[model samples]
Every structure is written in C-alpha cells, then in structure tokens.
Target: MAALNLTPSDTSTFMLMGIPGLEAAHIWISIPFSMFYMISLLGNFMVLFVVGKEQTLHQPMYLLICMLALTDIGTSTSIVPKALCIFWLNLKGITVCACLTQMFLLHTVTAMHSAILVTMAFDRYIAICNPLRYATVLTNVRIAKLGLVGLIRAILFVLPLPLLLTRLPFCANRIILHNPFCDHMAVLKLSCGDTTFDGIYGLVVSFIIIGSDLMLIALSYGLIIRAVLRISSKTAHQKPLNTCTAHICVILISYTPFLFTALTYRFGQGIAPHVHIILADLNFLVPPMLNPIIYGVKTKELRDKVGKYTSRR
Candidate 1:
C-alpha cells in the first residue's frame, strides 16, 4: 500500500501494467491489438474521406455519421497509441500531465459519442415521424450546431475531472495501473488521499451525461415505433424501420461493452484483474473498429460510396 504525498515531486510517473501476469505475451498480444488500431484508423478515416468527397452523401443522417466517425477516431486515438508504445518499446511510464490528458480525451470523446447517438436518434425520429419536414428540421446549419452542442457538452461535463484529480495527492509507493490505458476510476483508485468526492463526481458525470442521453434515445425510438404502428401499409412501416437498423446496431456495439465493463467494475467481486483490464481496453477499441463496418454494410448509400471509392483505387 502506498502513502499519500500532497506535495508535487520532481520525479513522478505511473507505470502501466500491460496485461498483468501476462508480461511474457506482450509481444504476441501486440499483434491483434495493433491490427485493431490500424483497422479502426483506416476504417474511420475512410468514412470521413468518402463522406467529404461524395456529394450524394450530403444528407442529415450521413452528416450525423460523419460526426460519429470523428468521435470514434478521437476516442480510439486517445488510447491505442500509448498502448502500442507500451507493448512494442516496453515504455510503461506515463507522466502525470500526460495521464490526465489521456483521461480527459478518452472520457470526453466517449461522452461525445453517446451524445452523437442521441442526435442521430433524433434525426431518425424526424425522418420516420415527420418525413415531410425532416429537411426543414435538420438543416446544414442546424446539424453543425447540434454537433457543436455535443462536443461542448462532453467537454463541459468532463472538464472538472482532471482539475479535481489534480487537487488530490498520488501515492508514491505504487502507481502501477492494471489497465493498458488511463481511466478515470482506475487513476482515482491509486490516489492516497481522500477520493470520495472524486468517485462521487465520476458517478454523477456518468449518470448525468450518458444516462440522460440514453433516456432521450429511448424516447426518440418509442415515438418512432408509435408512429410506425399507426401506418396501415406494411411496406411503408418496413421502409422507415429499416433506416434505423444501422444506428441501432452502432448503439448496441458501442454501449454493450461499456455497460458490461462498468457493471463488472461495480459489482463483480470475484472477477480476475486481467478480465477487467481487457474489458476496459475493448470498451474503447471495439466501437471504432465496428462502426464503419456496420454503417457500410447496413447503409446503402455508404456501401455504394465505399464500393465506388475502392473500385477507383
């Protein structure tokens, strides 16, 4: 156990526990982790590039997708690079400032990802519930404003986290993190001083930011379902419902791992440490890798554009 030192030290750094109890397998493990990183980068960048170049994709839904692609890139980029450095170069030490930056970026981007999903649900709601006014409701300027709001919301809510952490003194005894990347709760747990406020704030932020977004998304879908139910024509109902499949799939892939890991952290008493670490890592990795694939396969416009771009190259 480490003791708390409130004063700043000349040499202070946290050692990352890259797959604890599996140090020997770090080199081999890097292979798949690196593959996921590469694929996430390539896939998300392709979405951004293709959406930008293709004029036909300049619609509200795809525009929201562009926002999703950007958020995925931000979220994955925050974690994977440092993880690869740890695996390849055996560099497990991260400075205090760098660790705080990582935590901020990762959490903020995650909140933004959730926020974007809410907006996408709203987009779908309009398209299905009120198709005739979808254009008027979600205009280019309005879409941009919505994206800004999501970004601002994430930044505002997550801003206090680091400041709060900075006030606490870290234990000099042992700063080894069990996870590959820096997470809010993981870092707070290492502090030697009082962390009750930090923990409470963390829970409050998660609930207020992500919890509210989840409710709004559910409400949007509920309204959408009710509207669809009213449609007597089976073909008409199916058409609008099909438009939401991609977004729904993206939501599931993004949230399921996150919620599972969170629950395990809170309630899992007998779980192995490595399992917790792996889930935390995957919570960041899986969504970015799958978002593009899901959208490309389920969305006709994105699929056609991707095919067209790849064929030309």
Candidate 2:
C-alpha cells in the first residue's frame, strides 16, 4: 500500500466518502438527509423560541429541554452541513485541522448532550420523588451550575481526543474517510501510527461519560418507580409518571443509537461498513430530528406555547 502522508499536518486534506459503496444513490440519500437537517434546525429553534419567550417555561425542566435542544443543534450543525456538502456538492476534501475541528465539536456536543440528559434525569427524580423541594433543589443558580459542569466536563474530556489524533502519522494510500462526517473512530482508523491508545481512550471516555450517565439515569428512574409505587391511587402515580414520558422518549432516542453505533464500532468487526456508517449518522441525526417533535407533542405547555408562537408568526 502506498503511504498517504509523511506526517499529519495542517496541509493534509482528507476525502469524505458520503456513503461508501453507495455512491450511485447519493442524490437520493441527500434528499432525506437534507429534510432531516432542515427539520432538526426548525424544530430545535422552535423549542428554543418557545422556552425563551414563555415566562411560564422558565423552570428547571424546560430549561433542561432548552439545553438538550441546543446540544442537538450543535451536534447536527457540525456534521450535517459537511455531510450534505459531500453528498450534494461532492465537496469531499477537508483539511486535517478542519476535520479535527469538526470531530471536536461533534464529540464535545455529544458528551454535553449525555451530561444534560443525566441532569434532566436528576431534575425528574427531584420532581417526582420530592415534589416539595423540586423548585428549591433545582433553582436557577443550581441549574446554571449544572450546565457549567456539563460544559466543563465535555471540554476537559473531549478536548484531548483531537489533539491525540493530530499527533498520529498517516500511512494509508489515500486519506479517505469512509463516513460522510469526520467521526473520531473513522478518522483515527486511517492513521499509520499505533491507534490502540486512541481506541482505548475513546472507550474509557465513552464508559465514563455515557455509561455513568446511563447508570445514573437508570438509578434515578428506579427511585422514581419506587416513589410512584408508594402512591395508593393509580391516578396519583400516573400524574407523576406522565411528567417523565417526554424525557424518557428523548433519552431513549439519544442513547439507543449512540450505544449501538459505539458498540458496533468496537465489537462488530463482521458488520458492513455502510451499516456502521448509517448507525453513526443516526446517532447524531435522528435525535435532533426527533427530539423537538417528541417534546412538542408530549409536552402540553410547550405544545400550547408553540402553537401560539407559530400563530403569531
């Protein structure tokens, strides 16, 4: 095999394969992707608008929703534009520095999204289990602090990832990324130097960030279930449980594909390249496209406010 580059540098440009082995269908693929990206943008923007303008929504739960919306926007915006460019415009080449930048933004926003979900779980836990102290426990100050924690955690952990990858040497015949977007693993796989450390570091970070978030979210729901069970009237239990439905849907949408993609990357050696790429895209794209719809429909107050907001505009 011919070497692609002598060393990883700012001058190095990598080709982005919109969807490997499916080049003939790229035009058709772009249609759905463009639709999703547009919808994700509009939907998330609506959530932000409704949340920001509606004073009644100035609570912890809605605030967390706003955070989630922002995370979705950030994650999708970072990838979808470039992916679309690759698919529609056939502008596939991206500089090493640019690729790393996209990777950093995508991964950091993803980590932040996970952290936000954990915080939302905590919010629901307090709301359902200790209704009396819900407001007191999740005051604006505390919520702001939690947001800060999410940001700091994402910055600290994901910051080193691109930096590490930048240090690696490239020896492939051509720097062709199999995925439309600059995914961390997809990019790392092209390196000539030892990539074992990158893989391990990614796994460690995933376990620490996503695994812990999932565990805590599960724990929160467990406590919530126990509390709900204590209520004698089914009506009373349903009232509290209903409040968590939207969040649960959002969590499932966000985590399931993410976990599937990460697992397939690590363990699914026999899996098709296109399948892995699809799962990876879905992990980022589907959540953004679905989250706002789920929230808009499942949340009565947000739904009503959104209706009123749209009517006026």
Candidate 3:
C-alpha cells in the first residue's frame, strides 16, 4: 500500500477510501481498542481507588504509581474514545478548533506523562540509593510539587506546537483526520503558513521532554545500581531492587513507541501516510492500555494490594 502524503492544509479531511482495500483493518483495530478501553479504564480506576483508600500505600512510590495510573487513564481518555468513534462508526468530520484542541491536549498529556515517569524513576532511585533521605526528600508536599512541575512542563512543551498551527492559514480543504484523533505533525503539515517555527518548536520540545526524560531516567538508575551493589544483605537489597523493576519496564513500554512516533511524524512524513498512521495510532493507545496491566501483573505489592482491596468489596 502506498502511503497517503497529504499535509494538514492540503487535505482538510481524510477519507477511509484513501487507504485502498484495507478498510476492514479499522474494524479489526476497533475490537482490540474497545477491549483496551474497558481494561484501561477499570485498571487505572482500581489503582486510584486502592491508593486513595489505603494509607499503608501512602509512600512516595505508591504516590508515583497513582500519578502514573492517572496518566495512563488520561492518555487513554485523550485519544481512544474519539479514535474508536471514528473507526467503528465512520464519523470523520472535525472542525479546525476541535482538531487543534485534540492535538494540544494530546501532546501536553503525553509529554507530561513521560515526564512523570522520569520523575518516578528518580523517586525510585533515591529510595534505593539513599534510604535515610527518602522520607525527607519525597514528602507528600514534594510529590504535589512534582505533580505541579509535570503539568508546567507539559504546558510549556506542547503550547508552541499548536500556537504555531493556529497562526497558519487554513485552506478550504479541511475534512476529516484519517485517524480517529488529531495527529500533530500530520495536522500541522496542512497549514498554509511556514511551519518552520512549529517544526523547530516540536523538535525542541521533543528533545526536552523525550531526550531529557530518557537521560534522567538512565542517570537515576545508574546511581541506583551503584547503591544496590553496596548492600550486604541479600534479602535487604533484593526488595529495593525489585521495586525498580516496574518503573524500568514502564519506561521501555511507554517511551520507545512514543519517541518513534514523534520522530517519524517530524522526520518521516515523506515516507507514506499509512506507515505514519500506524505509528501515530499506536503511540497514543498502547501506553494507556498496557501500563496499568503491566504494573498490576508484574508488581507483587500492587497486585496483592489491588487483589485484597477487590476481594474485600
């Protein structure tokens, strides 16, 4: 299948017919997506209820998990319902304002989502590397502050992308986004204005949110591994090291596809729209659907806590 290469300005709307014979693919994708919606919402909502109800789980790590769960919920909320709506129902018309709103929140939430994961890594790192100071460092007040910082980072990172897009002159071709929701670079390309500034902004924000977060997560682990090696008790050290396993897995699951989509959308538009569409759709949907389940399945404490909590009711 050849890629559809329409910019946001050039094609106001994307018809399902553009992709040749694969219309059934959208239906197939919808089945998995609807299943994801149930699990993603239920799983994250359970985490919120558990952490909120249990004071024993009030530590920094659980606090961070709560935040991650919320992001998982929010990220899924930002993209999936709309995508499902378009895919299953064949509803494709989106106004310029509506599209930009989707793009803005999608970028902001995703950027913040990654930032919080990086912060969670740092929290785990500190808990492992410097046990005595963990309580002092990651106070409830501090966690709240970090939450604030994450929001600020999202706003700062994603604001420019849409702001640049708004300035562009929209030609009359605005129709439907081929995918369910807004694709930032995909939508941005449709602009009649010079998108150089938006492109530059997107790159800078990518490096800031994606690149910086990746480095921070790595550095935190480096310090963590060093501290883990110094512990004398096998049992004592094992528990701390085990706590980090979930964060590490979440980072891999969340970031790799994220960076892939961002890079591809920015750099790979010339390739084919079909390829870009897959990357873009997977980017928003997978993290939300998978992260909570992965954390629940992998982390014993979370599993036991959630299990006990569920059974009690």
Candidate 4:
C-alpha cells in the first residue's frame, strides 16, 4: 500500500466494493438484495400505516412496534440503496464525508434498533409481570420519552465515530473498501495512522451498548418467565409466552447475524472475504425484512388488521 497525503476533503473519495470474489455475479447477487430491500420498505411502511390509521392499535406495545418499524426503515435505507447502486449500476464512488456520514447513520440507526428491542422487552415484562401498573408505567408520553432517549443515546455514542475517523489519515493508494458499505472497522483498517484508541473506543462502545442492552433484555425475560411460572393454571401460561414469541424471534434475527459476523472477524481468518461481506450485509438486511412479518404472524391484532387491508385491496 503506497502512502499518499490525504485528508477528509471533497476530492477524497473511497471506492466501495461488492462481493470480492463474486464480482462477476454482482448483478445476480443483487436480485435477492433488491427484493429484501423492497420487502423491508413495504412491510415496515405497512406496519406504520396500520398503526397510524387504527386508533385501537395505539397502545404501548403497538407504539413500540412503530418505533421498531421506523428504525428498521432507517437501517435499511442507510445502507441498502447504496449497496444496490454498487451492485446494479456500478456507481461506487463515495466521498470521504459521504462515507463517514453513511457510517454514522448506519451505526446510530443500529443502536436505536437495539434500544427499541430493549424497550420492547421492557414492554413485555410490564404487561406480563406488572399488569396492574402497565398503563401507568408506559403512557404515550413515557414512550415518546423513551424513543427520544434512545435517539439521544445513539447519537451521543456514535457521534464520535466519524470525528475519530476524520483524524486518521487514510492511505491514499488504499481507498477501495472491500465491503458494500462504509463500515467502521473497514474504514478504520484503511487509516494509516495508529488506530489503537479508535479501535478500542469502538469495541468498548459496542460492548457497553450491546452487552448492557442484552443483559437488560435477558433480565426482563427472566422476570417474565418467573412471573408466568408462578401462575397455577397451565392454560394461563400460554398467553403471556405467546406474546413474547414474536419479540424473541425479532431479537434472534437481529442479533444472531451481528454476533456471528463480529466473531468471524475476530476468529475466522480463513473465512472467505465474500462470505464475511455477505454475513455483514445480511446483518443489516434480514431483520427489517423479517420483523414485521414475524409480528404479523405472531400478533393477532396486527395480523387481523393486515388481513383486512389486504382483503380490501
């Protein structure tokens, strides 16, 4: 890699890569990617539209669903369109500022999505374990506050990432990123400067945010499980557990690919670059496409409303 003097300027641009080994199949590869993006948009938008139109669905749980839907839309929009452009049109030149902005939006929206999941877990816990105080605990104002806090927390944690990247002088000859989007680690690797602090900060922030949120969600479910088990009636246990099924599915889909990709990056050096890139892409792609579908299948009210709308259409 030849070193060239480059700073974060308008002329500095990074070339985004599609699947490294599958460059020949970029067009073929985009078929499903495009489908997933479209499905994510349509499904999440339908969720928001349904929630908005039906006054009866304006409860804490549905409101949280709306939040998740918005974040899902954000997550998909932040990355997929650019990815599709690279895949289909071969338009891969992204300026340093644009790449940094994309990186920031990608991470912030992801953090917000994780927080929404935590909020949903809390919602389930309250509805099941503290049924009497559910309404009092999670009013519309409170939900709005929670969403605001999630946004602020996301911005606070992710705001420094682009700033950190800006300080690192990138190798002028090595501006081609091997992934579809401007990922934090991918961008960090391009920097010629000592990235020890930046890398450590990124990891620490990720652990603190993801680890703490996971723990909170686990604790919430643990309590919910304990509360359900204390019930004397076996038949009564099903309803509470059923409500959580959709959320659990969402959590698995949202986190599983992310954890797998993170672990692969640290441990799986032999993994193909294309494979890693695909997994990384799927981390952002899969959840938004599946979340609403899972909820529609598992949630009766949402399913009924969707059915009514489709039948009428």
Q: Tens digit of lDDT per residue, candidate 2, span 53-143? A: 8899998888888999999999889988888877777777787888899999998999999999999899989988888987789997899
What candidate 4 gets wrong by more than 4 Å, as runs, is 1-11
Error of 2 at 262 (Å): 3.4
Candidate 3 local lDDT, residue 70: 81
lDDT per prediction? 0.87, 0.86, 0.75, 0.89
Error of 2 at 40 (Å): 0.5
Name the candidate that leads on lDDT: 4
Residue 176, candidate 1: alpha-carbon lDDT:
57
| Candidate 4: residue pairs that collide | none
Model 1 Cα lDDT, one tens digit per residue, 235-294: 888899999999999989888898998889889979988888888888888889999999
Which is better, 1 or 3, measured by TM-score?
Answer: 1
Cα lDDT for residue 128, model 4?
A: 96
lDDT of each residue in 184-218, candidate 4, tens digit only: 88899888899999999999989989999999999
Clashing pairs in 1: none
List residue ranges in candidate 3 displaced over 4 A.
1-21, 175-178, 232-237, 262-275
lDDT of 1: 0.87
TM-score of 2: 0.93
Each model's Cα RMSD: 3.6, 3.4, 4.6, 3.4
